[model samples]
Target: MKHLTETEIADWVTGLHTPAILRHVEDCPECRERARTLASALQLFRESAREWADNRTPPVRMIPARRPKPWAVRWAVPAVALALLVSVPVYDSYRRDRQARAETALAARQAAEEAEDAALLSQVDTGVSRAVPAPLEPLVSLVSWNSGSWNASAGQ
Candidate 1:
């Protein structure tokens, strides 16, 4: 008798074979053992598939939430405002002190210049008040001679 092919055995194991191949498998011990092994492996695979499908869970995705600012950052605006409010008057006072010093320096320089001018004018007045001696008076007159005095001196 011809033995059953592996395809016939597989088909018989899955209940897809004709009655003739099934009869051959029933009579053939070797083919019966192969069919029995294939059936048992297929049953095991179906049980594993059912367990996996029933117990599987879908993946979860997490989204991040927005957090509030820290305490220091929240108070930074008021701190800066307080600093500006405290600094404005101090800066104004510093500017006014600087301007006063400059004006005092300028007034002192003007007073010194006026004192020097007054001293020079006093020296000029003293020089103009002093007179030459009598012997030098004739020499002074000759130096002041005009054209008439020049002609008279030429005749002499």
Candidate 2:
């Protein structure tokens, strides 16, 4: 087969040719090398084009035209108002419940402290009503007094 022309080679590189071009490149070393060079040049051109496009800044900025607002935007305010109406009462009830629990705990603690204080005062009264301390009560039974004098033996 005759060697492929530059256009034929280009078309083949771009996937535009038939099986004959593939056979020629396979059979002829010179045409095969030419096709490979063209393919490499095309790949370089594509990379440079991408890089140039990325580096280029747009000269004129176009503002996108806005479409009509959706139905949700119209009800946005009512939705927020409903959320607040639902949340405010729930928050208030939560705060009131916490306050009631704290008050109950405080009352119970005060009652316990008062009971402890009352028990302590009753112990003090028992200690003060004793004529003699309990440790010396046995000595009292061995001694007696009569006729304004000390007596060692009274019933013996």
Candidate 3:
């Protein structure tokens, strides 16, 4: 007769063996002793595990307190204030430069328009003055008999 293996004995201890293995164990003395030993060991382990699970307790934990920040780290606010104070004047100067450029452009445009008007007026005055020469003065006075300079009442 062949002897049962350790796995067959473990299966028999756990009551999971087939009918053939069970019959073999019943007839074989060596296999029967092995199955008995394995069963007793498994029973002892299960009892110990149950007792440990029932009697176990959770462990306690502790948390530490927070510390304050250093002095140099707290100086960030004043440093930012000083940066703003320095940049304000530079920004204002840039704005004033842009305004001055706009005003200069406006003045130059007005001066060019005034010069164009003066040139036009001079052309008109020159044309009108040249239209009446010195040789036509007497003919102009005779045609303008009703003029105040040649009054008929003054002759009377």
Q: Which candidate tops lDDT?
A: 2
Q: Compared with the true structure, what per-residue lDDT tens digits does model 1 show for residues 46-74?
A: 77876776676762333443444568767
lDDT of 2 at 44: 99
**Lowest summed lDDT over 10 consecutive residues: which window, candidate 2?**
59-68
lDDT scores for all predictions? Answer: 0.80, 0.83, 0.80
Model 3 C-alpha lDDT per residue in residues 1-156, reported as the tens digit of each score: 899999999878766678989999999998999889888888898778767766767522323434345465478788889899999999999999999999999999999999999999998887778746767865665553654565444346
TM-score of each: 0.40, 0.47, 0.36
Preferred candidate (TM-score higher): 2 or 3: 2
lDDT-based ranking: 2, 1, 3
- Model 3 score (lDDT): 0.80
lDDT over C-alpha atoms for residue 152 of model 1: 40
Among these predictions, the greatest TM-score belongs to: 2
